[model samples]
Target: MSIDANKELVRRLVEAINRDDAAAFEALVAPEFLLRDAVVPTPRGPAGFREAAAVFHAAFPDFEETAEDVIAEGDKVVLRWTARGTHRGEFLGVAPTGRVIGFSGMAVFRVADGKFVESWQCHDRQGMLRQLERAAACEGGGGR
Candidate 1:
């Protein structure tokens, strides 16, 4: 696909994420989509991707994702994004703290046949953990 098309695909991905639509997300991904990220567990594929989305949506029902920057070169696209939402459910073993939080992330996707096939991502997990901890501390739960 062309560079603009690749960038458009990434933009749609951000929309799907903000909407928390798994079917919409799956439509843009290849059948054998692979996710490579340190925070995510192994055996990652489209289903795993959907599961991760579910987890996030469960924690932050009103989660909104915005693409701050998008760059495309050949079949690869790099996306920098930020998400904000209120924590109302569990996230990565952290209990709900009812705190509004924001985090940034960057991901590079490889597209083929007009669909995302592979991705490598890095997100601010430590920063999110710190916010959660601080919220807990404020609630007398004792944070590190």
Candidate 2:
């Protein structure tokens, strides 16, 4: 596929995330695809990716993902995006604090045969933690 086509595929992936469409997500990913997130501390394959997405969806039912920009070269597509959602479930061992949070991240994807075969993502972990801390404060939970 061309660079434009790869970029479009990445865009659709982000859209699927915004909609929390697991089927769409699965369709775009290779069966053995690997996803590595800086905040997660480990690499996750297709099944693991699904589990992670499920946990995020359950935590933030109204999650929205916006792809700020995308750059494609060869079979690699790099995506910059921001995700906004309200915390309503456990996240990173933290209990629900009912706060809205927005975090930005950049992900590099390797596509093969029109499907994402691998991805490496780096997100604003400290920023997310700060937002959660602020939310906890609003809920009368002590400072972190």
Candidate 3:
């Protein structure tokens, strides 16, 4: 795929995430795909992305993802993004605190055969944890 096509694939991925559409992931991501640096270990391929999306959506149902930057070269595309939402469910063992929160992250994807073959992502887990802790403390629960 051309560089523009590769970048478009990444954009579609962001759209799928915003919609929380697992089927879209399944169609766009290769069966042998791998995602790294996520909150949890994802199984290979689109199933892993589906699982990862479910976890975050379960915790923040109203979350919206935005691609702040997208750049592509050859078969690689980089996307910087932010997700903002109100926490209404458990997250990594943290109970729901109805807290409004946001997290920023970046991901790099490698495309082959017009499908995402692999990707590495990095996000602000520590910042999110601290926010969750603050929410707990404010909601009459002592933070760990």
TM-scores of the models, in the order given? 0.92, 0.90, 0.94
What is the lDDT for 52 in model 1? 64
Candidate 2: which stretches are off by over 4 Å?
41-45, 141-144
Error of 2 at 114 (Å): 0.5
User: Which structure is stronger by TM-score: 2 or 3?
Assistant: 3
Ten residues in a row with the worst lDDT in model 1?
39-48
lDDT string for model 1 (17-105, tens) is 78777787678888788888777664555676777677788999998889999999998999999989898998878888899999999
Model 3 Cα lDDT, one tens digit per residue, 37-143: 65777899898888888888899999889999999988899999999989999998999999999999999999999999999999999999989989999898564
Better of 1 and 3 by lDDT: 3
Model 2: per-residue Cα lDDT over 36-56, one tens digit each:
875554335555666656667
Candidate 2 accuracy as lDDT: 0.82
Question: What stretches of model 3 exceed 4 Å from their correct place?
Answer: 141-144
Instruction: Choose the strongest candidate by lDDT.
Output: 3
RMSD to truth, every model: 1.8, 2.1, 1.8
Q: What is the descending lDDT order?
A: 3, 1, 2
